[model samples]
Target: MCVCTNRFLRLLIEKLCLPTYCLVDCDPYGFDILTTYRFGSMQMAYDAKQLRCPEVCWLGVFPSDSEKYCLPQQCFLPLTAEDKKKAEAMLNRCYLQREVPRWRLELELMLQRGVKFEIEALSVHSLSFLSKEYITSKIQGGVRI
Candidate 1:
């Protein structure tokens, strides 16, 4: 992984005008990373700036998605007390479970078939096309792509 310090990430964000990306990893770790990013404590992204808190958005991680995609036998870390409570709180929130879930489901399907897909899995042509489509769609929707 090309992990960077929070300070470096902060500088990169400022210097390179990088998107405030919130990655959707496996649920438990994903949440931990999100917390670290918000707190600017991640050893990775060590240079990530806390100039101002970036908007932390949750991608979907619904129970239904979990049911369909999660590998029951996979070893998963137990949630921290805070994480458990936060997850519960999220469940109580309106529109509980949001985008991560879909991605997770896609990942799970790939895993079940013994296939691996990474960000770089996209072909150059596909990447450019999708990027253009994504940006266009975002613009049309008045959302940051």
Candidate 2:
């Protein structure tokens, strides 16, 4: 698993060539990821051109996730009003289930069930996927091939 800032993450996203979708936990943090990936750095990238426009979208936002997961204090960064609203909406989404917490449900379930199904879990069966393109779409579609 790779963890990085929006700038570094944007590089990986632009490398991918696919119809990308962003699946994040339904919380302030997750919404921030979407916002960053879509709107560009809310603070840092202000001086530079935005990497890409929003092409990525949220996949699932599980309410059970909030109850089950514990966000690290550092990751619990502040959120704008819009971020909170979006997170709430995502949590209430009908498509998402409380089957697992959004933050670590996949990992917890794998241990409980002895099987792991990650987006990367399908890498073997699927063609290669690029993280850069994934972010590009969500950040902005202005990226030229």
What TM-score against the true fold does each predicted structure earn? Answer: 0.36, 0.35
Number of clashing pairs per prediction, in order: 21, 19
The segments of candidate 1 whose C-alpha lies over 4 angstroms from its true place after superposition are 1-4, 42-145
Per-residue CA lDDT of candidate 2, range 4-122, in tens? 45445566567764454566543456545654555455355553344533555455333332223332333222445665455555455332344223434433332233221223322
lDDT of 1 at 141: 60
Q: Return the TM-score for candidate 2, rounded to 2 decimals.
A: 0.35
What do the candidate models score in CA lDDT, each in turn?
0.42, 0.42
Which tens-of-lDDT digit does each residue in 9-87 have in candidate 1?
Answer: 6677778876565534444445445555544444534454553235444332322333433324332334456645544
Model 1 lowest lDDT segment of ten: 115-124
